[model samples]
Target: MIDYIMQYQSEIWQAIGETFVMVAISIVAAILVGLPVGTVLFLCRKGQLYENRVVFGTLNIVVNVVRSFPFLLLVVFLIPFTRFVVGTALGTLAASIPLAVMAIAYYSRLVEQSLLEVPRGVIEAATSMGASTIQLITKFLYVEARSGLMLGMTTSTISFISYSTVMGIVGGGGIGDFAIRYGYQRFETELMVVTIIIMIILVQTIQYTGSLISRMLDKR
Candidate 1:
């Protein structure tokens, strides 16, 4: 146990950094693209501030279609696109390509759903006050949905972490790869236990931190 860690310390650390790169890039990208995509989705719904059935149906179908794809299949499905984008079908960076696409679809729906939970009266009041479509979306809808948005982000990010584990099958480097290589392949039980603990700790920390931040943003 200790011997392996001591022997491959640099390799393990490199894998950790690789995993972080994949997850971090994917999460930030999801937030940037998902938030607006979701906002537009909600705004286009029938009877909303920016109602447009055409736009609503288009975005709705797109998001739903993307979300409905099985993630593993989605990754493999996107391989040619990924190769075009990242210039390769393997490694941490290449792995992020699929994660970002999946995250965008997954989180966009969550964001739209969260924004929908804002009371209708608040939206009506904003509209009555001459709030433009953009104003209503950015100020009222988002403000009301802030907590849910945070929780949704936390949830999606954690899911991405889990997804990264499977990326290793494609040679995407990460802690999961480490566990699989050292623990499963080499029959190193202690190494597997340690990696499992690390994953648990990482997940718990993300959950607690997300809760604290969401609470701070919530006045009610």
Candidate 2:
């Protein structure tokens, strides 16, 4: 195993870098776009401050439609759009377009769910105190649900890592692609095991860090 790693260390490192690039882009989308989308879903629901059945229904349907597609199909289906946006349907950047879309849809649902977990009393209290919409969300809802949001982000990130693996089908190389090409395809079982172990360790570290911070932030 050691000899194998030393022999292909550069390639392995490059694959890991590609994976990071894809996952990083997805993470950014989840925060910048997904968070707001989910917050809107929460605020637009019936009886909420910004309640509007039309807005809620439209967003809900879009989220559902996106989520309903099998991820593999979603990647293939978005090829044209991805190509148009990135000028190519191959490489880490192009692959990231689909990953980002998936992240937005996936994390938005999680965000909505996390916000739903916020107590109704808290929202009511904020309203009674005359909090503006922005204030209610930032100072009340998000403050109360910070821990849940953290956990949700942790979950989304792990799913992103898993999803990035399949991007290799479009020439988006990552650790998984490295394993497939040099391990499975080449009968290098030890290399595959090493890559799997690397992924496991990376996931465990993220989960642990997220959980620790969530616990620290929890007031109750």
Best candidate according to lDDT: 2
**lDDT (0 to 1) per candidate:** 0.87, 0.94
Clashing pairs in 2: none
Candidate 2 residue spans exceeding 4 A from truth: none
Best by TM-score: 2
* lDDT score at residue 55, model 2, on the 0-100 scale: 92
Candidate 1, clashing residue pairs?
none
Error of 1 at 125 (Å): 1.8
Give the per-residue lDDT digits (tens) of candidate 2, residues 114-167.
999998999999999999989999999999999999999999999999998888
Candidate 2: lDDT over CA atoms? 0.94
The predictions' CA RMSDs to the true structure, in order, are: 1.5, 0.8
